[model samples]
Target: MAATRQALDWPYPPFEIPAELYAAWDARAHGAAAEAAWQRRFDAYAAAHPALAAAFERRMRGELQPALAAQLPALLDAAAARTDAVATRKASQLALDALAPLVPELFGGSADLTGSNLTNFKGCVIAGRDRWGNHLSYGVREFGMAAIMNGIALHGGYIPYGGTFLTFSDYSRNAIRMAALMKQRVIHVFTHDSIGLGEDGPTHQSVEHVPSLRLIPHLDVWRPADALETLVAWAAALQRRDGPSALCLSRQNLPVVTQRAHADGAARGGYVLRDMAGARAVILATGSEVSIALQAQALLADAGVPTRVVSMPSTTVFDRQDAAYQDAVLPPDMPAVAVEAAHPDFWRKYVGRRGRVVGIDRFGESAPAPALYAHFGLTAAHVADAVRAVLGTGAECAA
Candidate 1:
């Protein structure tokens, strides 16, 4: 084969099959009859179910129905209009309810944490002995669920997503990395995202999972702040075809801090949720801490220090934005303080030299979420102090 390639001066690798084997295989398989037989089977299936065939055709072409896309604004508004705070996981369930029926190609499952993860919707039903269902119940197997989703995605026609606690992602890390490496559109709904999981302690809480997941190339990690952001993240995950997405959701209820008007900017990954005139500093936050950032912004304002609160749900997506947009959201000159219930190192790149990160640098303790937040100094007061300390205008946070 190597000599044949050299003689022909061909850049392509030469076939390695023996002459007899190649001739026999070609004589048996290469013919008009083989092509016609395959076409006949495809035509019979298409004729039997025209609608299903059309849907598969559209999916293969990478086309999302306009009806599905148009439903997003209404979904976002409805979620934003909620009178009380709701967990991002619950909001994710609501999104699945609204979108699942519309997207017949959406296949969902959970790693035996469906109730806690809120991954199921009306359209998702576990398969029975006598019937097929849209959702697979992958019992207590995070790695298996993720690996299976990768296989389903590679097979095409369906968009596969699975759910599990954020901490358990360690079990699925290899498959998640493979999905990113293969540039497959698999969605991982990781709930109970932080120490906010509370009394479950360090075992259930995730202090480094979010940052470690972010480090995976071609993986878009979204830690949405509220229902609106959750809905937008789901839509973004579905629309993104070149890579996988991780939706890290909070276990505790988060107040609606994002505005419906800023939905477009939320889709961009990061945006100024609240901006003050003559702002002197910026507080960057994500997930449940976004509400904390807002409170800190208010405290700073009361202290005669106007500040801007930036809700950065997905830093990976935000980094892909044009320089002008990125700078407009997080000004280079502004002293920044990043607040998250996670590791501190990941925020340093955004906060810069003089900035500080108000985050938990250690394993969580078994306690109520509020107490955990207070103990770790992930409160609005501590965040405000961090901001003030960075601006060189106040004492450092002692927490």
Candidate 2:
């Protein structure tokens, strides 16, 4: 519907602005520049889409609700505990079970890893054959999965989703970019999101994928911290009507954070958890890294260094908050550390140049995920040490 609303929809002028001339050309774009001229037409094109206008009509009358309006976050924490047991497999079955009635437009599939991706929707009135059921079984074709999802979204009757290993998103990168360019409402569920993929090796572990996905303009990126966080991420994807979103989750069973998930905590991106009475450093993390940061917070407290752990599930949502909100949550002044299994780029903007980040700038290894994590210094102790370095508190955080 928003095929014309995104920046990628801008028409290419007859005279191309060479990519190499970005610096000089950007400087030249004052007011009457070609880019500005192009924007007017793009804006006009956005207004021209008939279905888009209809969607806006709902929003104007308050018919639309924020995607993260309720319970999914808590669902994630609950799921985290279940993942290590037989429950991970069953919860997805339960997801299909719950959606059997209400989410007629809902669709999903696996990238040849049905047993692992855990996204299978059974019982459909329309598809007739269980073979072509509402949910598509995309086999190992990541590109086909994304492109097909784009088509499903463009058709206006469905919210298509698919799953694959986190590292494999690269195979579908072009299709995903097109979805962002088209502003399609598709979801990509990536499992085994880290070195925790274990013996699968560097090619399988998703080290640089987080920032790579974040770099896309219209995509919302999520790395859920627990089972409940996973639910929030899923609900957020369903609620976000304008564009695409991805949920990155662990292959290993990470300990659940709270007794249960809190929906509000999952949607707003970064939320403070386990704060010290007086915090000297703020440790921010997403996905499994949040668990590490939480442990680091406790260890730092025991050593007399007060630290606050921040769980950041979605960067795009957090960026939506006002400056005051961002300041309140991130507080540029606090000594900070950003931790994740992925590359460091995504955290820099949040933590600031002076703040430290415990992340991988390199590829993962073929060894067991736990061994690789310790080998690369990605532990609670490592995150705490980063905080200690920032605080200059003289307390050793290393094990």
Candidate 3:
């Protein structure tokens, strides 16, 4: 094996020339050798899977972008051009298709956790959920998982996404934060959100994770309320072309919600999920937490609070909303509180000093989610208490 010095034009140190790997010398070399090596690999792949090979070639040259986007041509071809909501739901499919060709480094696998995380990408790999057969698997080692994700993103062209229990996100917090700082497009599929995680116990519940992740600046955290939103969220994260994104999903199957108007859900970030009356207070929530907020709205209504619930999947998007829109969603007359199983840190801006927020703001126990909710104050009663506190009907509780 022959090795050359690092390329002056390139950013990092030189790569090692493996003694036995073919084209190891040119992996870092300039010109024809690199292109030729790619061709050889492509031809071999094409011979084996012609469909994938053709798609891969189109991707290499950048002809597959618009088709991957949920806009005109491809949408028309699919005969779903008029169905914006359905198109939005298909964003994840488009993402996988668009990404399948460009970054071979974009690898994913679940920890016996694919169904929950939505971490499996088609035309990719087949493996036991516990195994790393799909290029890389972090297993249940969430810390290492996040660290490896950071490495892949920092190295470039590799958008690494992985699956994990939402509660386990705490273990990988630092690495996740670093990915945010570096602004890499690493995907994190966090499942089993909230007490909805059921008998899994407080140990598996992710009450604090909601606000903790929202605190990261460059990290676009999206807790999609349903399957379509999940697809859209993944697509939006990929199109970010920069920054890291975390998708918080649920263990429980959420009802599918779609509208023919919001086909570009992924790119747009956030839109009115179901806006009725822009009432006095806006109930902001995400993930499994959103359901709580919706129920609270009805409870508040019978009590005469007259509230509006906003499914704010992306805080980053809500923050970017114009001042008028923000004020409209969250009127000054009606003080609001953010309800989620997580901490309250992420709600300060929206709920404000005058408002209230219902969140975990604490650690977890080894017990189950029901008991944990009792301990952490995440029940419907707790949510109502938060609303009353924010509305000045009750005193503020100590953090």
Instruction: Note the clash tally of each candidate.
Output: 0, 9, 7
For residues 323-389, write the lDDT of model 2, one tens digit per residue.
8877887777887899988888778887888888888898888998778889988898888888888
lDDT by residue (87-119, candidate 1, tens digit) is: 999999999998887787888889888899988
lDDT for every model?
0.91, 0.75, 0.64
List RMSD in Å for every model shown: 4.5, 12.0, 9.0
**How would you order the candidates by TM-score, starting with the best?**
1, 2, 3
Task: Give the poorly placed runs of model 1, Cα more than 4 Å off.
Answer: 1-17, 23-35, 128-130, 395-399
Ranking according to lDDT, highest score first: 1, 2, 3
Residue 16 in candidate 3, Cα distance off native in Å:
27
Which candidate number has the best lDDT? 1
Candidate 3 per-residue lDDT over residues 285-309, each given as its tens digit? 6655666666666666656555666
In model 2, what are the clashing residue pairs, if there are any?
A: 72-232, 74-261, 75-228, 76-227, 76-228, 76-229, 77-227, 77-228, 80-227
User: In model 1, which range of ten residues has the least summed lDDT?
Assistant: 10-19
Alpha carbon deviation, residue 138, candidate 1 (Å):
0.6
Model 2 residue runs over 4 Å out of place are 1-100, 121-132, 259-261
lDDT of 1: 0.91
